[model samples]
Target: MPKTILILGASYAGTATAHYALKHTIPSLPDPSSFEVVLVAPSRHALCRPATPRALLSDDFFDQDKLFIDVEQQFKQYGERFRFVHGRATRLDTEGRVVSVELVKDAGEGEVTLEVAYHALIIATGSSTPSPLHGLNSSGRDELRAHWTAFRAALPSAKTIVIAGGGPAGIETAGELGEYLNGRAGWFSSKLENPKVKLTVVSREEKILPLLRPSIAQTAEGFLAKVGVDVIRGVSVDSVSPPDGGRGEGGSLTAKTEVKLSNGQTLAADLYIPAYGTIPNTGFVPEGLRAENGRVETNPQTLRVEKAGERVYAVGDASNYARPAVHLIMEVIPVLAANIKRDLLRAAGESPSGEDRVFKEDKREMQFVPIGRSKGVGAAMGFRVPSLLVWLIKGRDYFVSMAGKMWNGQHWAKET
Candidate 1:
């Protein structure tokens, strides 16, 4: 008899797990129909979240459709072996091994819920930061497109822009805005007067990009300074005033806001964007499996949901496994898939000693900070790459071109 595997979330981690499972389990099974994999997500699109910071700037560089890849079509080659449900998982009963999902539909009707049973489950719901600057919307493509369109229309008249966080997303957004208003560095191509736009970045920490080494952090600060962006460290936002009025036909909102800071200061701007940290999407998970901050607590060795036993696992930002990154997901998927195969083989009365696997943290120091299309700084495998190289590698296209290939293939698979 075939066993069912239900995977929650259809982003990088979820998608990768599904692909690897098919590769490892299907070919080995005498009856290929003995295994089924089902993926459930709020939307059928695997949104390119890393590109959202740059994409929101304008439509000229980002084609909205490119950010959203159709997940169903991508898995069509598998036929009934794979299934994708366009809905959000609202509840879960780990003991019963059943998940309740709310189906998303275009037709105007009441909500519909479905209960799905699984012999094994993977939770990869991923995390989300504040919107309009942090990440792209996943409800649908139309909602995401509408957000970018409105921001671009309002930008020309937005003389003052205030960003509330100094993380990667905030920094990238600051850089893109700086380049859009003023031309390339050391080039005064624009005839506009001095202070074409007042841009400010507020960081609660003592330094911006605090995760990077001091020298590397300095390099990022230097790039922002060269591009005319004000980097203010050790300050936090206290309150933000509401918009004065609604948006006009041109998609520009009439009212700007006054932002109050912890340093006893106030700054007004045409737009106030929050780029704070990410919050784990673990609400659907059981309380016993969650941490104080709402992140799933998983076994460090096996990556299984703690106390929930070996048949269930959690990965990506939603789990307390370091932090979220595309590379991190790439590293986790294969180990998780191998472990699942080992457990399944054991259930089928086969030897499991050589099949079980463990996950270890990848300590390689890797980070690429691109300010705009032309320049950036990075450290790859502990070696500092030149800014020009960073521009060529990631700053130019925001790596959206490579994301699709990375998601659909097993470029990081490892043999245990």
Candidate 2:
């Protein structure tokens, strides 16, 4: 009988631990034949979300190598040693070390009882953007794309646009739209006709990217100006009323509803993109499993989900790890891998005890805030990140290509 290791979710945390374990442990194990590794996830390939947005905004920035890749295909040459199950997990039996899964596809949904008796488990279900921008919400990708395509087609003619929320998503959209206006300097009527062709960003927070320091916010405001984006700070939108029944030349289809802001003010727009916040998708977790704020709570060091016990775990944005989960895939989690290995080793023998496997992860956080594609800003380790580096790293398509490498190494590396 082979010792089994089950992995649930293969985005950043799940895939990293799997590849690390397979590449390092499979060969070093006392007996390669003694263990069987299985990975369970949807979409066989990992999706580079940071990069996905670029496919919508900029074409010059597109790089084929940066696109997401399939994990099952990456290690398929390894044969049956690694098994890939194509399904969605519906229920979890922590004590029994089994997950009740369902096979989801384009046509319809199906069910499968994948009994993974594991010596170890890795959980890495990531977070998701909560609302829709341009009708592109998570109502299902097809529905979103259908709405977004129609909205984008209508943008060229809109004389004014109102952007709600002053977060990174709003900032990025403002920059992109402003650049488009700037490019049409002489051609478009919106650019030639009136200086009041407004591009407003309404933020509830005093400053955008409030996670960043004061200096960082100041620099970003300057960048927005150069790109032709009107920075509306210190005020909130009260209400938005579209050109009613008899009202004249300009009307907006997308933003017909009235939006009331915190401050005593009102505004209207031909377009609106709500790049607001993310929500963890743990509601789908099995009944007995434990979670907080739609996320699975795991031991900070061990990555072992509390309710699920030894048989299950979670990673990426899905884990209640007491920190904003970053999408950067390179930040290593070797300690988690080591702990999983030790647990398996112990199961393989009479007693699997070894050195302390936990190592403190870096407490500091880092971000690369790109204002459009030309300029950027970032901070890490309490250092005010220089603007130039921010553009090079995050601002230019949000570092999607770099993260894709960590998730899908083989095909992406070859593409480059």
Best by TM-score: 1
For all candidates in order, the CA lDDT equals 0.75, 0.60
> What 10-residue stretch in candidate 2 is worst by lDDT?
243-252
Q: What lDDT tens digits, residue by residue, belong to model 2 across residues 137-220?
A: 223334444444555676676666666667776777776666656532333332323333456677768888776777788777
Show model 1 residue runs off by greater than 4 Å: 29-31, 63-65, 187-193, 243-255, 410-416
User: What's the TM-score of each model vs. the native?
Assistant: 0.91, 0.79
Q: What is the overall TM-score of model 2 with all chains considered together?
A: 0.79
RMSD to native, candidate 2 = 6.0
